[model samples]
Target: MVVQKSPQRAVLWGCGPQGSEVTVYVLGPTTQKKQTSVSNETGMWRVMLDPIEAGGPYNITAASTNPTNESVTLVDVLFGDVWLCSGQSNMYFQVSQIFNASKELALASKYPHVRIFMADLVQSETELPDLANVSIPWSVPNEKDLAPFSAVCWLFGRYLYQILKYPIGLVESCWGGSAVEAWSSPTALKKCGLDYMDEKLMGPHANSILWNSMIHPLLNMTIQGAIWYQGEANTNYHKDLYNCSFPAMIDDWRTAFHEGSGGQSAIDFPFGFVQLSTDIKNSTDDGFSDIRWHQTADFGFVPNFRMKKTFMAVAMDLPDSTSPFGTIHPRDKQDVAYRLTLGAQVVAYNHILTCNGPFPFLILPDKMYVYIIFDQELAVTPSKDIFEICCSASVSLCGPRSNWVSAPIKLWVQRTIQLSTELCPQSEEVAAVRYAWRDWPCDFKACPVYSAKTALPAPPFIINFQSSSGWKRRHIATDNYLSTEDDWQKMQNGFL
Candidate 1:
């Protein structure tokens, strides 16, 4: 029973007026007693479930008679995690884009635990409706079932379902050519100091008002997190708004969900985004490389935003050479899904991080502190045998026996090593330090056979080194070389 400004209440549907007393009553199958009133809150009431009444298939009816109406009944409902997946064409790309995605769909068809809720695409300029379409429940994936699903979303959902094995819910709100601005709340953009750019441009409703209406209503329904694969639309014209707009989109969604859901704060949601892919254009305007660099730098901009969460699957190296140039669509989406899953594997499952290749950069100190970082965890302990900081090119270091290179850093550790930089005591003054850096055949046992030797060539302004990796000798103009993170930042700032 629900009532306001009344001292008395009864479980009757027809409560006289707004300020009248109201009460609700329902006999429980296990309720042997005649009546019980357990608790009340802010003039509102709910049936308290005694231990015996907790588990039930019982009929519940609240009686209140008032023209204003006291309450409404909610049908069958389940509580669990829900994820909101949104983006542009890549996100809208369907499973059929992948080879035999139909088979994958068939396999998923057996599991009813996975639920997908799709919010129809709508753009709005006002406050969203209180509820979105829930007529659709979680469906089993089959050829017919998967037909209209986003391919990236399908694959990502499948991978998550496979691992979590829970009641996974997916809410896909996507439009192929939609920009980031379309999904933001008009007020949210204003908060970020953006002028309202609503399609109609009538007033302040330029944000993703529709997404708020259709999707925000489902918050507190519980959700794992989100996977975003967009920026194509925003970058289509080389808009740098992403530096502020993209992250704001995420934050706004979070704010709306939490607020609409009555400020439920238990969930510490994580968001994963896909860096714009390689097929993107390189035009001076909206160039893929430029956007990619922006996305890469974004990793550092958003606190706790990890590359592991936001993956940049390098499509530049994929072997599907038969691609249409200048076209936004890439036919091979299976690999796209696979790469995303690999990234998800790291974030959702706490998988070990390893270097995709020599990354971050290796720096040689005049004395001992050579700083280096691998993209992922080191598979092997840095040892003299595996990593040697060479000074003189003539001397070769092996195991602990080598007189030159210092001991390598150990596993799960990042640090600088100290070597006696007192010029190679053997002969010609030592020149440069050698990292696992090489070209052609890199033969680390754990290294994949297909791995190509990636070597850093001597720059015209850096000390010269001789190697078979097509590295040319160049004079050292300066001793300082930009590190990986540094270089990544410069590129992000458009300095490169």
Candidate 2:
């Protein structure tokens, strides 16, 4: 078993007889010892060890001074960073379900310092003081242990281990087909004005049940951060309330863990999550797209005002149609993990790098064209064709029945794209513009727009033009006119 270690200390804890004196000994590269007494009422004991280095293959021995004189010894122990991974079905997807399962399982032995633990799936009406069941205790990575564990969780920890070259401990607690409310605490729900319990909602998908059983029990364990892979179930129900409930849940978890661990866990720990991927091809439903936007609190990016110290991985470009589990369950988790790891390096480890793709920094529309300026250098594969412009001249008139026609790309230059407004009827005016606003926009990693440096896909977004003067004033203020022979020459010379 591996315990989470901070820069100066580590904690060891367990249950024992009431009022019994417990002694713990650490023997490895360095030696240390500590003693504590079990709580008379709660029968719980915790010992905070002295300062210790990160690397270890230590032996920990715990003995109690009770009548029974019971003792336990743990071998091959290490001190490192611990991370909790939880969410719905996508997070519950096993390692064997990913692409090239055989090859991944065979490579598990190479990461002996990375340990894993999985809590059993259960639910309760009230919060649990301790875990009722443990499916898999803390164990080093092996073919048997890696096959049944979460593929995304394993791959993420593996990537971090490779970069940090230290021990990593991952704990998995997730359920399939569970909604966001199921994992949210009552305090969080009440903050969102959704505290009332629905009796009809029961079982693994009910409100606050999974939080009580699965998450509450593990709050005592210190962790560096958390990563989530959910929101698919929320797309079917409570689709509009995600922006409120999701951020509330994240805040509540941070507070609970900080208090539960006696301030061992950071109050503002870094949080990372995977945005909802593609669902169906050629489907016009807006449920998946809505959830994706709400996942970031409608900001289309993380580390926003509502969600601080958070990072996100864009998965809209990855579409899986040949999975045995179904089209909804994508098999390529390698790319998802890789993208998430990049976010972690920047957010958690303070690494200096580009972690995200191009995002719209400014949208300027003129009489003949609309110029979309991105924050980063743009790279286009084939021609950009998924952009749509509203030609209704008013917000209320814009809908499926209105004039929302495809606006093709006319000119491409560094950090800017010229969208032709000629496709719209001359009688109508372009009122709004949106990009990749469908359930499934493109094939696997084939999205037309990307970052030239990072190769990450641009997230989908929509921009509205309230009035002609609003855009015209900004265009004149910024002085970003790009209709020149020099700009065209730069484009033709492959400078973008």
Candidate 3:
């Protein structure tokens, strides 16, 4: 079987101002070819081969002759899925700091499909349009390589390699103590305007500067998508600025890396980001929660082509204690990788295995009609004591009164109650019903409280924490789900 050659292209950005004449060489599966071009006025210049040439272990070397002699080398280059991994210290954490990163070194020793390109962490008061001293090259990942590549990035790349089985290139342009604005471009900031901050004169145009130094140059390459793990920097509760500003960066990069003859494909690349988690003490402050909620809300919204193609990795469950207070670095890279990998699995492979397996989404029903909406269509084995329906009392028709209940509703069944509706106080009076209503930590103690000893009739739903409460007769929506009054009744009826 003839192997399909990977797509080939070249990208050169911020070359004009850095020098007058720069010759690029493409050496892989063929003799190196040279091209002479001056960095454009914008300091951003790009070129794409009309017909992508051969692919292999390639080398891209750049030499400048603007006024002096300068040279740069990028080795072990290959045409593949190159992703730009950016964030705070979490994404910049060293691999050696992890538990068995060294022991796992053997497995990570040879990364044929994975390569890493790093940008030195640098920030300036002025947004430098053309970063002249960006000295870094792309190299294959190995334990002996960079002392500490981003821990999250390492696992993420490894996971992507295993899943796609394609060459994965990563560009890590992150800083240990930087905010979202530091990584965003001025274009985006300017667009965001002072409606938020007098950003006209902020610290540094981090995003734009980073793109200039770290990402802009690589835009000459081919990439599948990007995975982001940031927001800790902008923890000033500017989540609104972030939610709005972050998407713009995605758009800016897409615009910068157009995939056409000399432009990137107009297609908005899939951009997946990790939620900052509850690390911030007051997520409710500054409408931080709302900010995150809105940030999340924008994922698939309107005229913005950037958001429709994105996903959010939930870190709400991650341990905040992992890192000490005032500590900028959080070292739960394994889970970060796991989370991003799961997301990529869904984004890249469409491989859905479990609710937590990745790509798990909560589908909000338009209205709670008579029909019950199962977030996931699950199958169950019928049993006499399979589950129960409860309103006020601990009603058990087939088995002992249980804390959790799952009524097996047969497909197309018109029955008001699936499991025995008896002992449910007034069946129609039942204001609301809950399955597993507790934050039973998705990790460690994820097993349901009562279901562990007995065969569970259904998967847990809204996790419950405390014992039952009473509810006087109250009307519920036609869906028969619990109404707010039930909660009030439980307290007023002295059933707490």
Candidate 4:
């Protein structure tokens, strides 16, 4: 039988012999351990073994205390970092559907250490993922099994295994056309007090219903982290609520995992996710701005109740040209996985120290224009349609074709973009300055502005011009002065 390897997990199994006792033993490379438990009135006996240290290929043996010779042995037991890959149709997108599927599937055979537990769509009112409903078994990546597996998770785990050189466990728990609230726990909704969750939010297959069936059973299991690719469902309808609801849901999952593992306090495990990409349908400002903004602010506002870091892999570049407007799934998933791997490297692994694009450093409100400063390896590209300024933060002032103007700046070092009176012609007192704000109305090719040294796309942001407040100088982002973390405290507190 396959078992989850560990930081802390107690393996348990039932034995038969009505009211009999059982003895369980585990033998690893460096240690040997034993535990005992007796069967109840029913003919079932069980044992809760101790947690093993990380790194393994241990042997576990269990036998009935009665002399009848009832026993089970499991060989090549391991302790490896596991990750639960969850989300909607995007994350559930299979390897076979990708353009480079033949190549990816062929290469997947090389990583034997990576194992997956593919799951089925099961929702419940209160019941957990019962063993009887478990449809798939744990197996290594193979030509037969690789076709239907998640391309993003498989690639992410492959790269992670290459770097860490240990066994990797991936539990695929997702459903196509599911909402953000679907995977979220019920307790999270009550704690966060998510509003407007009327009949539309919970109709059996949507909202927190999946949490009881899809996410609940995996609670106590230990995992390295989770990678999510959702928001296509909720971003458009529940745009405003997502900012608070998303972070609260993340916190809830972390707490559930921590408490499930018997951590008295709480363990902050990394939770990285992919931001929503631009599409034809999302244009015309149907809530994407608010959704994207919150996805960016979550990491800064939602403090890891512990040491865990929250991160997002930007997917704005993944949308294809032909389907630039309505395209939801893009074929450039390899790049998407690579960006996620980079995020894991920085926030989770702490191996690299550089940004593909500059993060927003600060916004200095000047007389005629506002100076937008960026942090990290930034080199200003000849950005054409990358700038937009509104009279204020209200959507009413910024209509479909509002005071939208462009500020084409010259080639310079990657530090700042000056939004002059030329850009903010509608308002003398500029209320808000937005970069790459609108989803459409311009050519997709020329829209990106954050062309950093590493060429990573900068997250979309709005720095409001508060009359009372001004910019406090942080370290200038250069070789000598590097600071990617922005003073987002203002942005986090509804300042924008």
Candidate 5:
């Protein structure tokens, strides 16, 4: 088994005979041992071992002072950063189901220090103290053991190990086709006016059922952070409420883990999540796009005021129209994991790097041309045809869902793209501008806009503008004014 490794702490725990004394022996690099007695009431014992280095192929022995002198030994134990991986079907997608499965399986043996564990699919009406079952116990990576592991999780750990050169443990607790409410606790759901006991909620989609069984049981174990690949299920149910429920679930998990681990887990640990990828290439439903926006609390980027210590991996550019597992399940998980690792490097490890794509910070509408200014340098592909503008003579007639005309890129500079007003000649004015707004905006890695240096695809966004002496930015979803020129100046001065 693997014990979660923090900066200078590790926890080893188990159940034993009540009121019995348990002695633990650590035999590995920089040997250190601890002893603690089992609780008479709960028959449980935990030993907080001394600080140990990352690399470990250690052995641990637990001997109890019971009538029979019961003893157990754990072989090939490891100490490393354990990351919880959870979500719905996308996260449950197995390593064997991804592209180049055979090659990935063959390379599993190379990662001897990396370990994986998968929790059994179980649900309970109430929170559980311990896991009912474990599908795959802590095991080193190998062809047989790695095949069924979460693809995104494995790739993420592999990437991290290559950089940190330390042991990486991944715990996966996911259910296929499970809704976000299923993993969210009742306390979190209540914040969004959702009832776990609602008559319509039951089975895999029941509120808090999976959280009670799959997540609650593992709360005692300390973790470094988590990576999520969900939101596809939420696109179908309570899509509008996702912006509220998703952030609430994240906050609740962070608090629960910190308390459950007795403060071993950081209260504000870094979190990374994959934005909803594309589904149904031919369909025009706004469900996917809407969920994507809400995934980031409608802010179009993460690590904002609403969500702190978080990172996002945009996946709309990775669309798989044909797959045996269905178009919803994309086959290429390498890029997804790669993108997540980039964010983790910056957010979790405090590395200095460009982790996000260019975002539009300012938009100016001139007489005959409108200029869109980005936060970073531009890398415009063939052309910027993905951008669209709402062309309506009056703001009252301009709805978010209608009167959008393609605005081709007329001129491109260092960090700004110029568009001619003549493109929308049919209307007296352009009320709003949006980019990559469709469900499947482009083919895999073919998005027109990207970071010039990092190659990270620019996430989708919509910005509304009001006509006056000067343009005033408006929130896309809420239709509220964002700020005045003074606030924009503060943003430029790093006050926001």
Candidate 6:
């Protein structure tokens, strides 16, 4: 029922008797009201209202053409930055399940101004209107509601609310065991000659069923942006298609949410995501690393006009060693939330901040080693044995997680980490290098690799030997890193 408060913004959607008239009145904070009417409709009506300031406790009254003469009024509504939180189970991880859940729940009482609009789990083949079938009411944070809310999303909104001093709307739109393709719009899939509704991909529901049931309904409503945490499900099966498919989906969602919502101008809203953390046991392929690469692609590939198309929070370093790589759902939601908060600060809030640890860029020396460079410039953490590496003659033979072993990390300068080509046998071509790329140790030691000054958790990366044909990938990244061979080439030449 909440529409973004803007000048001539869409306020409501209603159905009345065919060929009948419907009326709507929106009362803003200052008792200023606007009246709009839809005459002779095919039972569907979209009402627009004048703009209100960012914070509001406004009232809206809507009337149908039904002879019964019934009306609905929404009161104490505020105009604020609305964010769509979507993805799979990890995105749906609730507050009650996080570390110090009791403390987080108690602190929840401090941010009553933050509200949540939870979309119930639903799947449909056809596009649906907002609340077409399922009805979930918007509620402010309270003890009863806070426990079950998505923990990462709550913390994101909590931080934004406290700092920005605005009402933050958190829309929980997710489903466990769902794949990326499931949430993609049918229109996007078909355009790319893909089948978002592939029956095999669909599991139980029809193709694009979740998109129709979950996302379609909310398209008309404007939002500040979206935060995504998915790909564990797609880690193995969809990693290949992810590079192209993922970017296309972001494009599609931007179109649908902005154009479909009838905004005043085209807006390429920010879409930030969490990189897959280490989960070595469950994934049979190196899908985690491959997908992470694709997620960061948005940063490199998307133009500045897209308004920071993506902000990726590296979860690779924040795993629970006790659970080891065996557990998929790590209990460290606090780190996840804070990392995402930093990303939002830089990307969404337009703040100049160091949001990532030392991200690697490789320069292959003709002589003895490969020099790994970084974006923010780097210094070595006072930890040793942090660089675990691998090498091979070819991209495939070396294979992900194939022949990895500890390597001597030579910190030549603040901006570089060096791996001696000697790690490879005499005269053998060293194809690639990966650092802190394996699963976390079973012990409780923190991830040893970090950016020297900022100490932000470093994201996992691969540096390949760029060659004539392409970049040669020999270092074994991990099981799920079975991304296409060119992935290494892209990482080296394209992103570098």
Query: lDDT value for candidate 5?
Result: 0.84
Please give the CA lDDT of all the candidate structures: 0.45, 0.84, 0.49, 0.64, 0.84, 0.66
For candidate 4, which ten residues in a row score worst on lDDT?
Answer: 476-485
Model 6 compared with the native: what TM-score?
A: 0.84
TM-score of 3: 0.63
Reference-based TM-score of each model: 0.56, 0.92, 0.63, 0.82, 0.91, 0.84
Q: List where candidate 2 sits over 4 angstroms from the true fold.
A: 382-385, 395-403, 466-496
Instruction: Give lDDT: candidate 1, residue 301.
Output: 18
Candidate 6 lDDT tens digits, 56-119: 6778777755454667788878877778898887788888887888998888778767888788
lDDT winner, 3 or 6: 6
Q: Show where candidate 3 strays beyond 4 Å.
A: 1-8, 12-25, 30-34, 39-47, 50-55, 59-75, 125-136, 195-222, 259-261, 265-267, 280-291, 298-306, 320-330, 348-374, 377-496
Worst 10 residues of 6 by lDDT: 473-482
For 1-496, candidate 4 gives per-residue lDDT tens digits of: 2344444565455546755556777877756555555555544444445555556677777877564667787776667777889888778888887767899899877887787778777787664634326545678678788788888888888888888788888888888778777778877676556533566454533558788787887765656688888877776656666776677778888888777656611366778888777666446664555676666453322123322487667776556656322367766678778778777777767786552456656665544655566765455556655666665445456543556566545333446565564555444445556666655423432345545566677766555444433432222222122222254344322223
TM-score of 5: 0.91
What tens-digit string does per-residue lDDT give for candidate 2 at 413-439? 778887888888888878777888888
Of the two candidates 2 and 3, the one with more favorable lDDT, higher being better, is 2
| lDDT of model 1, residue 265 | 23
Candidate 4 global CA lDDT score: 0.64
Instruction: Report the C-alpha lDDT of model 1 over 281-344, residue by residue, as the tens digit.
Output: 3222324534544554433212234322433343323323344423356556665666565655
Expressed as tens digits, the lDDT of each residue in 1-496 for candidate 3 is: 0011235344444354543677777666665555666645565444443334334676667777757677777676566566768776677777777646666566776665677767676555444444445324456556666456777777788787787766677777776655666666577667776223344434333445454455554455455667777766565545557667777677776766564225443356667776654443422243333334344543322113437666555544454444543323445567667766765676555676431311112211111111233323333333333333334332232222333344443322211223333434443323234332222222321221212122212222221112223322222112233335554435333311
Better of 1 and 4 by TM-score: 4
Candidates 3 and 4 compared by lDDT, better number: 4
